[model samples]
Target chain A: MAIRWIALRIIQEIIRDRRTMAFFLLVPIVVMTLIYYALLEDEKAKLGVVTRGVARFYEYPLVSVIEEDEDIEIVSLDIPDKETDPAELDRLIMEEMKKGKAHGILYMDQQLLSERFAGERGAIHIYLEGSRPTSTAAIFSSIAEAMDDLTETMPVVIDAECSAKCANSVNIKAIEIKKHYLYGSEDYRLIDYFLPVFPTFFVFFFTFIISTITFQRERVRGTLERLLIAPVSFSQIILGYISGFIIFSSVQALIIIGYILALIQISFTPHQLFALGVTLFLIMIVALTMGLLASFMAMNEFQAIQFIPLVILPQIFLSDMIWRIESFPLVFQWISYGLPLTHANIISRKVMLQNQSLWENWPQLLSLGGFFLFFMLVMSLVALKRNKNN
Target chain B: MLKIEGLTKRFGKLTAIDNLNLNIPEGLKFGLLGPNGSGKTTLLRMITGLIEPTHGKITLFGKWTPTSRMIRRRVGYMPQQTAVYPGLTVSENIRFFGRIYGLSGRPLEDRLNDILELVELGDKKKEVLSNLSGGMVRRVLLATALIHNPPLLILDEPTAGVDPVLRLKFWDWVDLLVKQGVSIIITTHHISEAERSDQVVFLREGKIIQQGKPFDIMKRFQANNLEAAFVRSTNLK
Candidate 1:
């Protein structure tokens, strides 16, 4: 019963400062927005199409063929005349590339029509701005698809027959490929892979900071000494702090995922939403208790800040957010598994990508349970030691 | 009443309190007098159950063991530093301290109003600790210490910043508490304040050098006053 009062008092102290409101709510909204927009880029790569002596070539069947690809959009840049210098055209295309107005240039030669009309080989220059990776890949694939449309459709003449009856021997088997996705559609963006882990990282990062500093401040200000003299027990103190952060972190996770759903239009099932919430709540509790343990290791707030590099930065580099956990070296992979954030990242990704049921996530839940028990035990012991010291 | 036996506390190579024993009776104001780094505060902390002695037996009200919840609830401690949370208002702090001692409902509210009035903070009850003046904060600290009305009050330098006139009224209040059978243990540097205590124990180097009433010690040392008597009792002379 007294735990509620303690937790409420702590939350009251934290929320009294306007900085908490801005940092916990506004800053997260802003960072999540950036994640959404950064992934929104390169959905369609614009290709600049330039040509000479091809006034009627735009009417060719390949124009509609290339435009049919959803990933590529062609922008026609008129050449001054059929005799216009190729250098001038190249300069115009380069200028467009520099301004990010186009991903690449597909320069059509007059031979494009003549070669097809004569049943001969035809060549066109595909100049790509190789510096832009995502857009460049999409543009390159679209150019390949445009070329295949003509090659794959042509009727093959067996033994180079010139007679109409010989054309009957030609085999033109219709080939169509169908693709099915397990998780998402064919047009998956980088943000789809990235958004799953963003909430976990954000919750871990900010909650780690707040919990460490809040507990450290209590020690530095001598309030913990006062509290020890009260009837409150060691476990109650640790439990009180965790409860307070649970309230804040739960709200933070909901707001982040809710904002993503509203603005970025990421659909989520109720089960997936619960999974994300549970993932966040478990990690936040771990961070909160770790912060409590860190308070004993630090004498003041500055010392607590010093812990960020040793305690927080390692989780970022090694916690399987940017790369696969198995991709790490053997020893580092072991270390990643040891850290609680790794499990949190996995649980969140499973929830987001696979919509995995909460009941199926028992292994990760057990790991978190172990972590909670360990941190709670250590934190209680240290707090008792501190009470004695004070 | 409290009795401490063979109490010793050592921090690594240095011993802060060594083999000290004393008996404190009910309704007595015992003054622990010592210089800095002496064992006065350490003794108070052990008695209040905030820290454990390296080797000791403490008997409180016929109970053999210390650091029990009953003992903690019965003993109120006000440390030298300003211990109130700066974010909480004065009334909030009072109610919190009251609740920790299991005070609730009308009893908590009544005690809250009374402590606020006694601390002369009736108008500032709604004010946060951060916005209060230093003297006001000190008043609030004392109010928190007195809220639970514990049987034993352990005050460490409670009158450091208060003016002389308020200090007199503070002692009058202490006298009232003593009359009500509440044992008061205070540590003060001021010799004049030490004279008001029914018993005085001068400690140095984690051991008591002298223990008696101020008048008895003064007469034993052939000194004119308590201050001169303390100087004559110590090795400084």
Candidate 2:
């Protein structure tokens, strides 16, 4: 009964604070929306084709074929016949790329054209402004598709003997590239691949911050001392707070999950969504307990916030969010395993994207439970010590 | 009733309470009088089990220590700081402490109303603590402590910032509690407030300089007021 009252009071206090409410509920939605647009929205890549000699005759057909792809835009650059310096042409292509007029440059010369007509394997030289990996990959795939189309529909202007000989020697579809997915489809964007991790991280991050600051404030304001003087035990206090924070954090989790799904327009099975919810709930408990333990070490609100770099930043960097944990060094991989977020990310990805059941991902789920227990145990010990000393 | 034997508390190199011994009888208004950092709060904290004594023992109502939950329920402590949550309504703050002491349903609500009336905050029970004035917030803290109706009440500077009118009302309320067989342990810097206590102890540098009935101490020092008596006992020219 005492625990229930304490939890109720905590809920009342937090609900009355408008700024904290906005930060807890609205900030994640706004941040996730920004990430969604930044990662998934693709713009058309412009390619500048420099054709010299006989290659100029292929430019119109090549551009027409590549332009069929919505993601690629082809621009034909005209150069005077006398200005045949390779360095000059290369400089011109580089200038176009630097000016942002083109994403890549395709150079097709006489030797490459004759080789193609002679039924020999020809090489196409392409220069790319390769700053962004996604854009670079997009440009390469579009050009590869355009080349495949060119081989299938050769220009009628080609000599009948050469065309017939080249067609007889080369199979039109020699390399049929087929795509098959074990889980997600070709329509899945980079953002969709990363979406499951965002809510897990936000739930953990915000809960930790709010719990730490609130616990620190309770200590500094002398309410904690008053509580100790009451009949309530330290464990009850910890449990009461956990129960209180869980109510709101659960709502926060639901908001983030619903908003992200609606914004990204992705559907999941009810069972998978339930599994994701369970993973996030466990993550919230771990975060809340960790924050309580941190508050035991902090004397004031500023000191509580100072723990962010020490506690939260490492989870962000090593939690397999930006880089896969398996790809990390052995030492870092071990550290990632120790963090609560790494387990949460792994479980969330498996359940949401891989269509895996919770039973199949029990190891990671068990690791999260372990982290929660460890944090709660340390927090109880610290609370006991603080009652005696402070 | 409370008894302390060789009670001592040290924070690293500084001894906040040193070899302190006192016996507080039941139903008496006991005042701990001291200047800043004189260990009055530390001694009260030890007696209330807010902190463990470095070396010694405390017996509360025949119990060996005051840390037991049953004993904790019988004692109420109001810290020097206004320790109420600013985001909660005044009624909510008082009711939370009441509920912690196992009061519930009609009993909790009745006690909540009684405490609010005693603190003269009945009309402002719905106001958030942060919206209240400093003195009103202190009253809310007092309400939370008094809401439990413990036999022994330990208040540290309960009327520090209260206006003169409400301060008198607080004394009246303390007098009423004592009259009802409640033992009150309080610390205050206000000399006049200390004069109302049945017994007062003057402490300096974590040691008791003088202790007895307020009138007896004044008489012994050949002084007209407890403040003058306290000054003479501390040897402050």
Query: What TM-score should be assigned to candidate 1?
Result: 0.73
Per-residue lDDT tens digits for candidate 2, residues A215-297, read: 88988898988888789888788889889998899899999999888865357999989999999899998998899888887
Which ten residues in a row are the worst by lDDT in model 1 chain A?
A: A173-182
What is the C-alpha lDDT profile of model 2 across B77-169, one tens digit per residue?
Answer: 888898989999999999888988999999899989888887889999999988999989988888888887899999899888789988887
Off by over 4 Å in 2: A1-168, A326-328
- The segments of candidate 1 whose C-alpha lies over 4 angstroms from its true place after superposition are A1-177, A263-265, A386-390
**Which residue pairs in candidate 1 have backbone atoms (N, alpha carbon, C) closer than 3 angstroms, thus clashing?**
none
Q: For candidate 2, what's the TM-score of chain A, rounded to 2 decimals?
A: 0.58
What DockQ results do all the predictions give, each relative to the true complex? 0.35, 0.50
TM-score of chain B of 2: 0.96
- Residue-by-residue lDDT tens digits, candidate 1, A240-330: 8877788788888888887666643356898898888888888888887777777677756755775655566557656767654443446
Cα displacement (angstroms), candidate 2, residue A25, comes to 33
Best model number under DockQ: 2
